[model samples]
Target: MAANVEDFKKRLDEQDLHIRESWVAAMKARIVRGELIKCQRGEGVNHYKHCRDLAEMYTGMIRENKVKGYKIIDTE
Candidate 1:
């Protein structure tokens, strides 16, 4: 029983890590696709907004994946 519990916990941790990596990958893809605008100005409010939007999208993706029982592991 203890071993099964440990395994479950490890799986959960791995899933969380996978989700985070997925978020990073999604954000990178969005940047590559020009969905996220480049900040010509310095690190201003627009830059912050862009980053926040990317993060929110990532979070949404994570939630969606979890609901589907899919682990989002990053290959790159």
Candidate 2:
């Protein structure tokens, strides 16, 4: 029963991760398509300074959905 519950929880987490990943992809697409400006109008390395908001949001999402490393076992 505990294994079943763990599997169910893992499934739910995977679904949430998928939804978050989709959102991130859409945001990236908009930025790439120029529909959403990700940085200020400038021509220097400092241009990234204007993108702190977007960067922070992206980082937050990634950090929130981060998964721990797990080893895969091969049973032949």
Candidate 3:
């Protein structure tokens, strides 16, 4: 039983890694699609970091399994 548990955990880790990579890819795509254009809340806002911030917000909500916690913060 212990062996089985370890195997399951390992598999889950692998799957989660894949999901994380996918989320990062999707976030990049979203940013490339003009999703980060003028994403500031007001004047004197960010210009370069907004893309990364928005991408992190988007990826935070994505999940590949129920064991993961999804925290989505509005960036735009």
lDDT of 1 by residue, 1-75 (tens): 999999999999988887786677666655633543444244466666656675566556545443223445779
Residues 35-62 of candidate 3: C-alpha lDDT, one tens digit per residue: 5455644323565565677656555644
**Model 1 global lDDT (CA atoms, 0 to 1):** 0.61
Candidate 3: RMSD to truth = 10.8
What is the TM-score of each predicted model, taking all chains together?
0.43, 0.42, 0.44
Instruction: Supply the global lDDT for candidate 2.
Output: 0.60
Off by over 4 Å in 3: 35-76
Residue 39 alpha-carbon offset, candidate 2, angstroms: 13
Ordered from best to worst lDDT, the candidate numbers read 1, 2, 3
Candidate 3: residue pairs that collide:
none
lDDT of 2 by residue, 1-76 (tens): 9999999999888878777776776666455434214354442476567666666665665555444333347798
> Residue 9, candidate 3: how far off, in angstroms?
0.3
Against the unseen true structure, what C-alpha lDDT does each candidate score?
0.61, 0.60, 0.59
Q: For candidate 2, what is the TM-score?
A: 0.42
Write the candidate numbers in order of decreasing TM-score: 3, 1, 2
- Model 1, TM vs. native: 0.43
